[model samples]
Target chain A: MRIVIIDDSGLRATVLEEGLRDAGYDDIHIVPPRGAFVARLERMAPDVVLMDLGSPSRDTLEEMLMVSRALARPIAMFVDHSDDAMIGAAIDAGVSAYVVDGLRKERVKPVLELAVRRFNAFAKMQTELDEARTALSERKIIDRAKSILMNQRSLSEQDAYALLRSSAMNQGKKIVDVAQALITASDLLGGGL
Target chain B: MSLRIAFLPLTDAAVLAVARERGFAEEEGLSLDLIRSTSWATLRDRLVYGQVHAAQMLAPLAVAVTLGLSQQPAALAAPYKLGVNGNMLVMASDFAAALDPDTGRRLSDPLGTAHDFAAAIGLWRRKPVIGVVHRFSSHSLMLRYWLASAGIDPDRDVVLRVLPPSLTVEAMRAGEIDGFIAGEPWGSAAVEEGLAETVAIGERIWQRGVEKVLAFRTPWLEENPDIVDRLLRALIRSASWCDDPANHDALAQLLSDPRYVDQPADLIARAMSGQIVVRQGEAPIASPDFLLFSREATPFPWRSQALWIYSQFVRWNMVEHGPEALAKAGAVFRPDIFRRALADADVPMPGANMKVEGALGLPLAVGSRKGGLTLGPDRFFDGRVFDPERMEDYLTNFVSPL
Candidate 1:
């Protein structure tokens, strides 16, 4: 079966392509975000199309359905009646599929399942990367706030840290939030270390 | 009760936003979880698969989904109309110059400009590509209706490209499309940027025409009558608030939030107040009744309006016209539920479920349960009437280009 994946992110498309390749499906095409996507897909009439649910071009595909003459065989979304859980999972994972009408469900199920699994993996990796970046920035902010406190109040580093923790607890906010507030106040008051 | 509702960011979605932000939903003991969708296709899927309790949807899309034109066949119903007559057709400057030079007159006389558009097709650089929001959208159906009247085959003489309403301006700037027909703020944005000029307004094509409706899955609506009634009541109160002239400023400011329509406040205000700037740097033209949310029973979903949409499907060969298909399509608009929800309230309702569409030449007060109910003029520009009893004659009247 021929499959085409439409996604704007190159890395996500490459990962999905690699997963499909490993599953013994050789005819795979990746169409990135570019001009005239519908025309490109028309030239390569794939049996099944995999697309990111967030892509705005999905409406373009709907237009193709209206002008049926443009397509070889009318394509419909691959929504299996017997498998509601799998379909819901695919939607939650931001994956959608459109297969040429009369294509067997048995042939399309595995391909969609593989896409869902790959998309979830990519999402988890992205979340981890974002969290790591945020944590590093918060740490730097907290260190700067502690040093300013130590210099302005003539207190030790340990005492400064305790002061920030108590202030955060009193204000019902996070330590990073309190630390950021301290840094802003110090800069505004011309007392930056 | 908490209900999740899906909607696109457009001026017509004002009712839902007002319902949630202004405490109308809370007053009825309901919490509305509004999910902003990027495309109508995704919004349909969300409502079809039980992700949302309801959605603000295109009228024909609700019918098309019931008929199973796209995706799996799922029965959907629209008990309340979100808004009416808020869409516009805009053409690029170079192509528009071929038509009437006076932009105000161009929109005022759509029939005359349509012929001019037909004559200008041969003078263009290439095939004119017009952007529509969706295949089963009201704007697309209206474009086809207006173009066919002037001997322009929408499918052959010109190209209909589908783009999201928000992306229409960018696409026009990129020269990917010559023009687009979409709901407000987007059309106003295009005109403000001097990229396009207004050719026709939907109100003139078919005055008080059906646009967006509050759609819900059939099974879900049947299972929870109490919840549905409460939500409709909330929407009724919200719609009244949106229609008031005194509230337009506050309403525009609320819609300008980044979480909603997310355009400039002044640009969004122009559509709500009906002071449209059709051309770049031109003085605003006052066209009151340009967009109506609740005035004159506007929220009522007449079944005859649904039949009008069904006829268009047959006109374009989108669906095979049959009694079974016609009944199914007409059943998509649930006026019975609308009446049931407002039975106890002081709201006045039309006594009939269906009427002859485009027959009303002027505002007429019809029989109603409560007193003081008047419907405004709803006439087609070509002076053709669509009577639900004579669907065959209406379909035969449109002479297709052989």
Candidate 2:
């Protein structure tokens, strides 16, 4: 299977290439840390893709999801994370899978297996965390949203949150979206939502 | 006006289901369309571009959005909290057993798991790594929180990495990971399959803290206040239904639907019921439920909870670059909108300093349910007594206005 690994991690790409080669499969190309990933991955046009979870920004992934979803040029092939359930879990966690349209499962399993392994490696590190407070990388957004809710709706802490939670439910939205909305709303509402 | 919303699939995604099912949006004279988003970034983009009016999002994602992490013109805003404490920390069973049986069977504090976890890393000589679903999730923060509290430097001491929830269990059993922190059922399933054991529930440590929130574009809410209000009312109702014990089964079925957790209905139901089977070759046993979709469990947003999150943000340096982090958090966390929604629904809102008892009592559903006889605590970590009025200063401190 001619595969292109679109990932930001060198170790992951190496590990996957090695594993796939070991499994008697080799037509593999690695794309490491490049901007405009969608364009490059498509330019490469490999039969299968072994992408990494948490590799790029949410915007990047969303673009990829849309590109794959809309164009059907690349279907969301499963990550080598483990199995179908794990890929679903990744999707739930905001990661996605893309494959070339009409790619057969046999053509992708080798690539998927490697992607799953690398994804597994990352999962190993994460499970050992034993708690969820590790995201210094992503805390800025949550705090900003909380602050907006507090200032705008005149919400006293939890009430602002209830506003967020209820909004998510009533609007069938995500908490993050509700938070983003409140900040946007505050800006438009002139500091009061 | 019709507002578009993108929802990530999780137990908490029920807000979307409840909103649509309850007809709250229609009642408010607003058109609602919920798009099931596969990833957080997609949800964020759809919401940001006005493609979707709102979303069921990560609490931290909203905060991150407002801070301009995504470099978007729009910022996530709202004091509205989506949900709380539907997370768990899990370890493979053999890994747990290897964690020094010398510590004795009767153990307190999940830190024991951490200690054993560190030891397991050493014993297995496995990478001292763990998995979280995303970089910007409560699981990541709580993993850091628990590890840091245990004096394990989350940064230097161990390698902190991100992975999808699906891989956590297999990773643990395969020795790819010694342990993991996630929403639910993953840990329980590990224990059930003899692949892992539950070290703690996020609820056990932080209690009913806000884990997720609804986010909207600032322009969207300003343009449509009535729609926002309507959205909240339905959410409040959904939260209420989730709280009822009888609805647990129904919720599990709802969540297990292909659109929700998408696992088997029974698996989703068991997780909701807190029925955990942590050992392979053994019967499934009950454990503390995640209480994601549970009600009364949903509303009553706690400033203390928000403050708790902010403290961690400050502790980790995630609060920088924002003007008056505390004020910003205060501004975003809206008790006002919450009260309006709950009051409109005729549900008595819990005080900002309310000391309400947990709806799910300890010793879940009766005599002799395995793992000894015990009930979950109704207390906080400080043991100084949790009070809302006292938490204001701390929460306000989350973002000190410049």
Candidate 3:
């Protein structure tokens, strides 16, 4: 997996880079503290992002938050010290792992693995949520279309749904799509039968 | 109560460090955990999110947070001021050479130096990029106030870069920025390495300018009033110790720990004693009132000071002026809470919640709870007095860039 390390300190970046290298991860990129850091990360599109900030000012945190929001990769941030509020903000900004006052060479591999795992887990959950939301919205649209058909044709709810399913099967389309088209046809015809 | 507090690695964090190190917290039935953060943003977030019970925050930052400028809008409160007037503006040595030759005179006269800075800006090859600790920092506000007095528009004339104070010296070394304004000993660190020279001290811009504060989330503070009171009492005791000349060495040593400031004792001691070395190999200047920790009601959180910060925000067009926002900003500095915490202490408490900021030309007696409260000079270098009561008039008086 490709790794990108964002650190303002040259010395600490070297330490983290060396640790990552020893763990047999060679596709590592170190970003300096100048000129569109997030843009550079986007171009690199690393699998995981590691940031070691000696002291992160508000500006830096905001910039990092922008990157976290943009990228789907796992991100692990290491700081010399952190407050509860900062940690919360970082998490809210989508950081996978936040290690405080624990910048050691041996700790890097474990943290990286854990961060990637957590990120994958979070991504899976998010995908599930999105799928569920889309299904629920589609179900609502299908129900609305069924009710419209029933009102126009004087049919039962079950008959309206059966007609929708049969139309979808004959056209090789989703029930929601057929329902949507029927609703559109009725609306365009000024709601008459 | 067990309290975890966040602080930056600066000399101004001495009171918090000493409070935890010298058993002051323990004496008040509190266990203090002092976490050293690298930037004001992190420390502010720590307090806002309930990660730490409190934080050593920039005076303006606390106000800005309450004003919803920093990040998420959260009501933050400052019950105690940690230190006053400890920050300074430093320019690269090459940049300094273009300004003033006499270091002592340049350090003393802000107006003269500011004019020199304006001239230097003209002669410079490019728009000089100066690093400030944070956008809402007192250092940035002071820099803008100083530069604007010389008719130098900060936004148009120069590039104000945001950087962490600890990395300022390195940024200067890399030529990423030409100068930086931050709390000691970062500025002193730059001077010590022959990289920069002190241009204007915060004290010279505004004597006893509000700097760091013991800031807490408003909800957390309201819920834990007794805990807040205990923490304030401990901090007040620690502030007194920090102010005492006898404990300067010990305080410096404690601050020099790798966990805290992590600088040499002498460098930290210079700020603690108010004897600053502006340049390498030059005689240290005796700036006796360089930093005030406890005396002169320095710990009291004046609502007027918060209004003054709000005025600067209005001046900079950072926020629109409205009575509701102004009231919220003014309420951030809880003098009532300070009075409540230190009611029985030997320390004298100010009788009123607000005062005419920068009105005191010299040490003057003021009505106090315990009597004998003598406030020191708090004159703005531009000779502008800010009456908290007349905020709209005070704001209208300024020729703000907006």
Winning candidate number (lDDT): 1
**How does model 2 fare in lDDT?**
0.59
Model 2 RMSD, rounded to 1 decimal: 22.2
Lowest lDDT sum, 10 consecutive residues, model 2 chain A, at A58-67
- What is the DockQ score of candidate 3, to 2 decimals? 0.19
Docking class of 3: incorrect
- Find the 10 residues in a row with the least total lDDT in model 1 chain A: A62-71
Query: Cα miss at A189, model 3 (Å)?
Result: 99
Give the DockQ (C-alpha) for candidate 1. Answer: 0.71
TM per candidate? 0.96, 0.60, 0.75
List candidate 2 segments past 4 Å from native: A1-193, B22-32, B70-73, B100-108, B166-176, B281-289, B292-297, B321-323, B351-402
Worst 10 residues of 1 chain B by lDDT: B101-110
Q: Judged by DockQ, which candidate is best?
A: 1
The C-alpha stretches of model 1 lying farther than 4 A from their native spots are A65-71, A147-151, A154-157, A183-193
lDDT of 2 by residue, B113-167 (tens): 6666666656755456666766567787777766655556676666554545555
Q: Write the per-residue lDDT of candidate 1 for residues A1-193, one digit (tens) a residue.
A: 9999999899899999999999999999999745687888888888998988877788887677556676779888888889889989988998999999889989999999999999999999999999999999999999999999999898899999999999999999999999999999999999987
